[model samples]
Target: MSATALPAGHALRRPVLDDLPEVYRLLVAHDVSVLGFPDLTEDDLRDEFTEPGFDPVTDGWLALDADGVAVGYAWACRKGTSADVDIDFYVHPDADPGLGGCLLTVVERRAGEIGRELGHGRIRAMVGCYRVALGEAALLAERGYTVVTTFHRMRVTLDGDLADLADLADLAGPPVPSGVTVRVCGTDEDLLRAAHGVKEVAFRGHFGTVPQSFDEWYGHFAKRSSTDWSQVWYAEFDDEPAAMLLATNAFVETDNAGYVQALGVHPRARGKGLAKLLLRISFAEMSRRGRTSAMLGVDTNNASGALSLYESVGMRPVLEIDVWRKAITLG
Candidate 1:
């Protein structure tokens, strides 16, 4: 594509590592405008660019204003040629609305080419935006995408005396019924496998469940330098594993917050208070470490009443994100 083809007064170019600083700045601007906080970091952008499926050369683009300043950016990728592709794009508040659509058009076009290369007849493109991004929402809807689900960023302050940590140990609720015990994981391979198993079994029935092989799942966390393996926990009933909690310190270094990356209870263990026990365990541990808070994201309409459960434990919704999807077919 040439500058002449771009929306008038805008120029598009493929992104390179040299553009990281500019990209990061644009992202921060977008985040501050949309979330009132700079929720992104240079490391986050680096990780996304290095992710397994991302191809920087063909999968990302930067839009510059007439003055040659980057004002918008977009990227698209799929996991191992999967038909389902994830797309993300950001535009500076001062950019032309047409620039946003222009980048989105390029992203969708690249997604289609990727789907074809993967031997898929059609591609399912998924995108997310803050609920307050009304213009983006309308743009997506007008382009045939429909809202499929919503997620809430939940958080709770973790403040208590070290000696009182014991009392806060079970914020989720009372201990699992008799014959059940929960404990954090160590660096044992068997233990990691068991934790992954519990998560797989527990979330199989969840909405939009996409099954990832064990290696793929574990590899993801292993690659994240901020993940804390010790924060991973498992709940056992009568010596049989039944639930798991995989957490990370990703937010700790940036926001001074502990994060629950994944939490699940096996179907057979439902209603046993295991979920609540694991949650409180996290709160207690985070507080003991002197973290200011703990946070996690949950589906707003979760069939398992997860929203109510989190609220019951004093975690309030701090932000909302909506996922939209559109089908792409190319002749």
Candidate 2:
């Protein structure tokens, strides 16, 4: 595309590596409240592009301003699709709010090309904005996207001055109902594959359920992520996959934070206290890693009342966000 102008001193173009620090800054100043990844580092930025199995072309973008300034970028992947997929975007506050729509147009055009190349149907996108983030909220609202879902950014502070976990033993109410076991995983692919099976079941009726192959899961999950398997937790009962928690450390410039990107319990595992046990296990692991806090997100209307569960474990909702969506059936 050629150069174009917005209402004021604004324009939109592609981004480059120099935009890394700025992107990180924008995400930090805005994302922490409703999303995780509170901190980011140049290494993190570089890793995002170089992480073993990440396909940068399919997952990233560069946005520039009128003066050729790298303003912001919108990026996401095919989260899932049975004819529709969910994509995520990150826009800058100082950039033209109007750019959101233009970018969505860009996304549709680009994704269509991608889908055709790979052979697929319509592309579904999921975008969200915290009410506190007026720019983001306005951008999505103006883009012809409608609110479809909501989630909360939950956090648990590991304060040295705080009461001990032992004091919360009552909160630990029940064990894994006997014959159930939970443990950490190593670099074993088969075992990882097993854990993923549990994930498949756990995410069956999730907000966006796109058919994801195990190859896709392994390619993206283990390879693209900055995972420390030493930090991941998994649970099983009667030798069947029951629950799992996969966490990664934040590569941010500040704040020693650990993030549990995916946490779920198999439908059959519900009410067994596996989720909370795995959560406490995650909390203990984070403390061992010297992290002062840990965070995760839960859909506000989660069928399982997950937000309430997190709160019961001292992970309070620090922010709320609404997911806006436009079905791709328009074509």
Candidate 3:
């Protein structure tokens, strides 16, 4: 990738923990301009600093203007030593126009370096763009990135009527299939491991999925401030773990919504109502906790018909994000 120089009066450097507040502001500003509301939390910003296999010093960048105020930020993260890298960058809406492209070039170069270090001859860098950000999408297209798939941010409001329905359903007992039972995974190591196993098996064929060891998976989630053990649930068929769901407080800070981070059903357990049942249970719990809504993201092209399932549960698309991909040949 060719280098793009930043505008005059701007300086770029590695981001440090001290830059967290400024960087968070830059991100929120960018999102607010595009989506009309902030989609990130300070905790989410902090979690990125310690993501697995990510080195903020080398893989991240912060751009400041003449007064040394943060105007742009970017980072690239490798997926478990694989050639696939996830990248993201943001420029304040009022910042100079060229800052975003400059930051993207820097992170793309870093992604290439990561691929070479992994001894891979080719690599793929993926980024997500808000569907409404036409200018941003045009810039990415100019740099050779192409849309791979679209993802929808789906949400369901937990209003009084829905809350009442959820409570009635709970009183009627879980609507799970015969021989299947669902319960929270709690803090039990074995149960957590089982949940991890179910996630791996269930998402094996998902688009852009990279296999991760149980320790890797657990460490990644355990270190996140949004993680709540009480929100993790697993379903078993005939006493054998068959499905898993992980919920987090990701949207609680900004949207007052409970976020379903992951929901997967083992192949052996497909065709059963386990997934829907877990979602209903989650809605009940979120309502009980006084959350106004629940949200999750799903790939529109998911082969499992996840979009339909979510829609059947009264969830509607609130926003759309397009996944962009660019493949590079490593030297």
Candidate 4:
């Protein structure tokens, strides 16, 4: 750990695996202040440390006060081989206000180096801020980042009595299409591949989507401590894979809810009620598993009518997050 241009009594250093607890505490404090609840579990933070291409040594920085207590954290992560980089910085509400700018500067510099290494002429630095955090949003605006899009964290309460697929349809949505079947995706490699394929095809042209190989997709979830393979589901139209839904234990610890990590229906399969069908199926399964609620995030401006689809299934917006972007030239 070495001191950077931090305040006279503060220092910055690379975070190590041993710093998980302290880092989690810092993050929860920040989240609680801005979002009114701790949105990330310790396992979630652990997974971030091991994300496919993230290098804890060079891509992250931790700020500490004179007493050596953690006060801020920041990191820059490149999305696959693309020029789009996701960066986040959090400062303790009581910490020095300038600490965020210092940490962000380090993250931006690292993002540039990443873009140049990948042979990109320029990079887009993006960050997500809670809509209610006016100060944080203003800081990003001051640094030339503009709000690109807004995302809503939606949730639906599930009644535990959804005894069967038939009951699910009666309770929430229409019955599955004539030839469509929905089933839990076990650990079978072939089934996993099919689900991944459906996802890649379905998410094409969506905002901020970076295409990923099957191995990349699998490895990302496999490394997450919270991944539950049984929670993954896929749909088949006429015995051909046409949609997929991936759920995780992301909200189990904090909200006693099942988090829908990804839900997608192939282009050719749209407008056939597959999305709503999958949502209802997932809700039933989560309810059966004793989860009181199901949760997912969606882009408010999604052209695919996803927001309306979720709303139709009883999911309501519980939180709003804004994605901000700033273009950086790699020289």
In candidate 2, list every pair of residues with a backbone clash. 13-64, 14-62, 15-62, 39-252, 40-252, 80-210, 81-210, 85-124
lDDT, candidate 3, residue 242?
93
lDDT of 3 by residue, 1-331 (tens): 2349889899999999988999999999999999999888888989989887888998999999999999999999998888889998999999988888899999999999989888889999999999999988998999999999999999988754555344234523356668987878889988888999999999997998989998999899999999999999988999988999999999998888999999999999998878888888888788788888999999999999899989887789999999999999876
lDDT of 3 at 230: 94
How many backbone overlaps does candidate 3 show?
0
Angstrom error at residue 309, model 4: 0.4
Ranking of candidates on lDDT, top first? 3, 4, 1, 2
Model 2: per-residue lDDT, tens digit, 1-331?
A: 3212233555544445666677677666446644554545656666666544234466566666667655556665454434444455555656665665555666656556555544666555666567576666676676667888888878878645446445233322234457788777777776677777888888778786654677877666565446677766678888878998888775323567678888889988798778888877777767766777878878887887788888887787776778887655433
Q: Which prediction has the highest TM-score against the true structure?
A: 3
Which stretches of model 4 miss by more than 4 angstroms? Answer: 1-4, 160-175
Pairs that collide in candidate 1 are: 172-276
Please give the lDDT score at residue 331 for candidate 2: 39
- Determine which window of 10 residues in candidate 2 has minimal summed lDDT: 167-176
Candidate 2: which stretches are off by over 4 Å? 1-39, 47-61, 80-82, 86-97, 114-122, 160-177, 251-253
Q: Global lDDT of each model? A: 0.82, 0.66, 0.89, 0.88
lDDT of 1 by residue, 45-80 (tens): 877777766878989999999899999999998856
Q: Is candidate 3 or candidate 4 better by lDDT?
A: 3
Model 4 scores a C-alpha lDDT of: 0.88
What is candidate 2's local distance difference test score?
0.66
Clashes of 4: 0
